[model samples]
Target: MESYGFIDCKDPKYVDTVKAIERELLFDGLLFRYKNNDDFGEPKSSFTVCTFWYINSLFKIGEETKAKNLFDQLLSNSNHMGLFSEDLDFKTKKC
Candidate 1:
């Protein structure tokens, strides 16, 4: 499987494209939902992977403060056992 950001052949525009996609995923709700259309045309109720990706992307883009904020948000999604399962219900604010 090809990785999203891996570039075996260095293209001058590669980094720019990756950064643009990352920013869009982080900030554009419409694009995010559209990309994950399989999950009810949006994200699942609990999405640890998505949350983690957001944090990772922030760090990759040199936004340490923003990355920390996203990290805190992901941590907040943990359950009573300090563990995050598969889904987080945004409406109920529970995982």
Candidate 2:
């Protein structure tokens, strides 16, 4: 909803919904896409794409400073080769 400009952050409902989404999916500041339902069953970790999406949403919600800080943290989690897999370890800052 945030990506396609479907959400108007100025509106209270959109803000409430996004906040609820964030509250439900955010894990230790990282965003987890969803609960286990995939063929793989349970989730092993948070998806990197979701992290980017979360950051973008933060920007939309007027949290630029927090978004930038999280963006930096996300970059720091890249592997030594500057490579990223689908999943990242938030605690270790590694992929």
Q: What's each prediction's clash count?
A: 3, 0
Q: Candidate 2, residue 12: CA error in Å?
A: 2.3
TM-scores of the models, in the order given: 0.58, 0.76
- Window of ten residues with lowest summed lDDT in model 2: 1-10
lDDT of each: 0.55, 0.77
- What is candidate 1's lDDT per residue for 40-68, written digit by digit as tens? 56664545566576566546656679679
Q: Per-residue error at 87 for model 2, in Å?
A: 1.6
- Candidate 1 to truth, TM: 0.58
- TM-score, cand. 2 vs. native: 0.76
Model 2 RMSD in angstroms: 2.3
List model 2 lDDT by residue over 37-88, tens digit each: 7898866578888888778877877889988998897887788788888987
User: Global CA lDDT of candidate 1, please?
Assistant: 0.55
lDDT (Cα, 0-100) at 8 in candidate 2: 75
